[model samples]
Target: MAMEASEIESLIRTGIPDAHVEITDLAGDGNHYAARVVAESFRGLPRVQQQRRVYEALGGRMGGVLHALQLTTAVPE
Candidate 1:
C-alpha cells in the first residue's frame, strides 16, 4: 500500500526538524512521489549524502509503504 502524504512528510520533518519540504505526485498516483527538501542539517553534506539522509529518515519505507520517490535535498542559504 502506498503511504499517506502526511505521514511521509511527518517522517521527513521529524528527522530534519527545520526542513522545508515540497511533495509532488508525479503521475497522479500516490506510489510515485517527488520530494524536495531543504534543511539546515544538510549544510555541509554532499548531494548523495543529503539525499541519503532523507532516505534514512524514512527508516526503510522506501520500497514498501513508500514506493518510488524522486528525491532532492538542499540546504538553505
Candidate 2:
C-alpha cells in the first residue's frame, strides 16, 4: 500500500513536533515522495543522523507503505 503525503507529514510532525515538513509527491503516485524537513533539533546533527530522525518519525514505514523517498533535512537559518 502507498502512503499519503498528509500521513507522512503527520507522522513526521508527531515525532518531531517542532519540525517544518514539506512533502511532495514526486511521481504523482503515493509510493514516491520527497520531503524536506527543517527543525531546530537538527541543528547540530550530522547529515546521516538528520535523515535518520526523519525516517524514525515514519515508524519503520520506509519500505512498507512508503516505497521511495528523497529526503532532505536542515536547520532553519
Candidate 3:
C-alpha cells in the first residue's frame, strides 16, 4: 500500500523533532511524493546525510510501502 502524506510528515517529525516538513503528492496516486525538509539539525550535515536522516525516519519503508520520493533538504535560516 502507498503511504499517506500525513504519515510521511509524522515519521519525519518523529525522527527530527526540530524539522519543518512540507509534503506534496507529486502524482496524486499516493505513491510519488515530494518532501521539503528544513531543520537546524541539518546545518552541518552533507546533503546525502540529510537525506539519509529523512529516509531513516521512514523506518525502512522506502522501497516497500513508499516507492518514489523526491526529497529536498535545507538548514533553517
| Per-prediction backbone clash count | 0, 0, 0
Per residue, candidate 1 scores C-alpha lDDT tens digits across 10-74 of 99999888999899888877899999999988988899999988998899999888889999888
Question: Deviation in angstroms for 62 in model 3?
Answer: 0.3
TM-score of each: 0.92, 0.97, 0.98
lDDT per residue (tens digit) for residues 1-77 in model 3: 99999999999999999999999999999999999999999999999999999999999999899999999999977
Off by over 4 Å in 3: none
RMSD of 1: 0.9
At residue 20, give the lDDT of candidate 1: 92
RMSD of 2: 0.5
Task: Tell me the TM-score of model 2.
Answer: 0.97
For candidate 3, the 10 contiguous residues with the lowest summed lDDT are: 68-77
Q: How are the candidates ranked when ordered by lDDT, highest leading?
A: 3, 2, 1
Best by lDDT: 3
**Local distance difference test values of all predictions, in order:** 0.88, 0.96, 0.97
